[model samples]
Target: MSAMTMLAVGDIVGAEAAAWLAQRLPILRDQYEIDWVMVNAENCSVTGSSPIDGFGMTTEVVDMLLTAGVDAITGGNHSWDGPDVDKVLAYPQVVRPINVSEARGQGLVTLDGAGRTLTVINMLSPTAALPGMRAPQPKPLWPSWTELAASTSLPGAIVVDLHGESPWEKASFATALDGRVSAVLGTHTHDASLRGHILPAGTGYIADLGMTGRLGFSGGGFDPAYFAAQLRGDNPHKLPAYRLATGRMTLGALLLRLDASGHTKAITRVS
Candidate 1:
């Protein structure tokens, strides 16, 4: 194919947002003539097993996304949160962060669609760590990109979800790989950055893609109380149970147009 369009979505908050996305994503795909779709679903399972249904890529959620036209699913810092993460990691269509030493499954998955093949890479930032982590932030154990790239034969248009915190590290990483891959989209920050642009060498870059969920201060997933208490130096154990924010659904995404050689010709913000 001379040109292909790939939709890279930001982190999803809860089941409500996931289901809603399933219903409407196909329409967007059709509208853009999208050849591939990748979504960050680390937060998708944060709510646990509830009436709304939650946990890392539940079987039902996987089915919904698959049937709804999603080609690949990527994860974030919450990759190893619960037993659910293990389950999703086994599915060919789902992937967790590759940089995590102990993350359950492969960080990269090859997706065949739109009359061509594409490789979806999911990896964490050395600076992005959650309470679930056994190590500290900016951990030095992260493997170098040169080493990672040398280890694999990226045969198709490569789209990477560089899930991380530091804008410098993420941007530098993407910059170093310019022309070697299609796009390196950042996630983890729930607020989208306005820096979506193609690198001088042709790889598309963005600091953060925000999120696809309810519009709110607490990532549209939880009520403001939890984040407020945490910021006030309140004891985390004493914080009230997280309250789900019920607000208007919103989408944060980027549309990448890649040429036959896998260099992104354009990176358009589609939020």
Candidate 2:
């Protein structure tokens, strides 16, 4: 049976990270013989001049990634960060969280990759420490995703990017979608999950794909010292300005192999 490979990238931390990826993604793609590429780009644009924070993706970076051969761009809690983000969301190939808002943008995208049709969905759990979400998490996955699948003329191999906080919750969600989707990949936490494996029902599952930014910091690519001061409730005045860590950029993602029917044949890390 013929098969194709997809590279699902982890959270990108900043514009530099995006630019860095645009330069080297082709090498990674060639190295893996990858057919399609998807990225969790919510953090591609960092906001705030003081007490800085990860917000949403920017247009330039998104365009850079797309030019670098990224087939799909997925968003998380940061999807609604600002008007600039709205422009990013409106990109034809971008997929925002389905439950967030239908009027905002599409929740999934169907693309032809390597001569095969593929469906990609981006989902964000409401209770995931998102800035504006309410106390109770808004879960529209079960019936909602199933409903969307039923209504759309989707290809057999569907991949879901479940951006959530809790690991077990992500696992359970993937389990529920096990036999139906081709793969369920988790993001949000920057660390790579060691559990990349094919489920009994033929779906590929991984707790997280990790980050495509600098590693070894408490907050993945941010100033850990500043983050610690905030956590300790130190005087905001005394803390240094927050900034992205300076280091060698790294690529974090997964290489998934699937057949025409969307059954995962192999799963491995691409870092």
Candidate 3:
């Protein structure tokens, strides 16, 4: 049987990070022998001052990622922020959370590559909403992964992106679907977790893949001063100006290798 490799990138923040990924991702894919690439781009266009769900993720940014060899782009709570979100989601390669009742984008997508068929599902946790955000976030409906697996006729592989706030919640979700899916990876924390392992039934799991943005800021994307003011309650209503961090930024991703039957063979973190 043949083996297929995939790379899942963490949240991408601001224009700088997007450009960084575009330049380096192809090389990384080649280096790692990756056949597919998935990126979390919820914060791709966020500037500190803009509304959380009203900015970020422009068409140019999406195009850049697509052109950079990313096979699929996954989003979380902030997926609806950009003006072009509806149009972007219309693309076959992009996906939003399936649990969102009112969101316009497709929650699940299927791709064929590397001699296998793969289904990728994107979902956001009910706890993903941050306090003080203007937009009202939706709560997950807690769908059954086993049922979802049974309903889908695709026989190759299944991978999920569980974007959420609490580690326990993400872990629990992964455990519940351990044997049913090929992998369940956590996102939204913007920091890589030490936990990365294959379950007893051959499913791959990771707590969080971290952020693929500038390193020296709150959440790895916002300016530190902005968060400082918010913490001090000095400027609660005023949005701070968004600035990409200065100096080097990190590219965070996880590489998974699956057998022809869609069972995980190996998982590695590449930063």
After superposition, which runs of candidate 1 have C-alpha atoms over 4 Å from their true positions?
48-55, 134-142, 217-220
Tens-digit lDDT string for candidate 1 (60-90):
6767788898888887666655556557778
Q: Tell me model 1's lDDT, rounded to 2 decimals.
A: 0.76
TM-score per candidate: 0.89, 0.90, 0.90
TM-score of 2: 0.90
Q: Candidate 1 clashing pairs?
A: 45-55
Sort the predicted structures by lDDT, highest score first.
2, 3, 1
Question: Which stretch of 10 consecutive residues in model 3 shows the poorest summed lDDT?
Answer: 47-56
Candidate 3 lDDT tens digits, 188-258: 88888865889888899998988888787455655677656666887667847646666568877899999
Alpha-carbon runs more than 4 Å astray in model 3: 131-141, 144-147, 217-219, 237-240
Give the Å shift of residue 108 in candidate 2.
0.6
* lDDT tens digits, residue span 1-271, model 2: 2477899998898888898888988998899888889998877877654422345777888899999999999977776664376688789888887765457678889887447777899887754644433212345667767777778776647899998877888888888888898999998787788769799898999998888887645537766787788789999789876777777777778999997678898999876
TM-score of 1: 0.89
**lDDT score at residue 148, model 1, on the 0-100 scale:** 68
Q: After best superposition, candidate 1 residue 17: deviation in angstroms? A: 0.2
